[model samples]
Target: MSERIKKELALYKLREIEIDDMKLKVEELKIGEQLGAMNYEEKVQSSMNCKNNDYVMNEIETLEKRIRFNEIANKRIDNALKRLDIDEAEIVRRVFIEKKSITLTAQELFKSRKSIKKSIDRAFEKLKLA
Candidate 1:
């Protein structure tokens, strides 16, 4: 692989790792939020004046951190794509980031699905060769 493409691939891989980390963090945040809700319900039911303010604050902080992490990761990917001069970031964003079907992406881009597939393949090949 060309050094340039290798570098881009490495950036892409790093971004993927960050994304996976964010996904896990999101799941954890969801669980924490659910627990916080349940705690609020319990406090209400008991009428003991138990305060879950701290719990709510902690969950909010965690959620904010996760959002920040995701934002940074996204920016990194954007910069990497730009550095590679792939000029196909939109295609990648639609097909991969948006999880759109190949056919849908092709229709949206006004290109044949086969052509889009071929382009994607060539991009990867070039990346590898770089």
Candidate 2:
């Protein structure tokens, strides 16, 4: 369970970074559209039926789907954290989400290293991840 939680935390961090990058890509696509550089479609539909925004939206649709997937994964991680007590959640976050060592977390949280380790063990017992 501990190992699984750690792996999920790592994936959560990765998904978060990916979501941010994909959002930036979407923004760049929009900026390109505004700059009259919209050329996302390889083949044209009827020009009478097609609007300018419609041209690039097809491309943005794929990117938005990827962004939404990562967002949902992050939300699941958030919900799991919400199930924990505040202190348990904080310890888990510092140890896993922040990638901090028990010793470092102890120093930051003003607790002993042994205390931090105990809290981490207790938190791991209660944590559920997907």
Say which candidate scores most in lDDT.
2
Who wins the TM-score comparison?
2
Off by over 4 Å in 1: 1-51, 84-87, 125-130
**Each model's TM-score, in the order given?**
0.47, 0.79
Query: Which residue pairs clash in candidate 2?
Result: none
Please list the residue runs of candidate 2 whose C-alpha ends up more than 4 Å from where it truly belongs after superposition.
37-56, 128-130
**Per-prediction RMSD in angstroms?**
8.6, 4.4
- Candidate 1 contains a number of clashing pairs equal to 3
Kindly give the stretch of ten consecutive residues in candidate 1 with the minimal lDDT sum.
46-55
Give the per-residue lDDT digits (tens) of candidate 1, residues 1-130: 4454435444554566676776677677667766656554665664433345455556657766766776676666676456333536566656655667889989998989988777666655644543
Tens-digit lDDT track for model 2 on 33-108? 7776534452265553356567578778999999998899889889988888798789888888888888898898
Candidate 2: Cα lDDT at 82: 86
TM-score of 2: 0.79
Give the C-alpha lDDT of model 1. Answer: 0.62
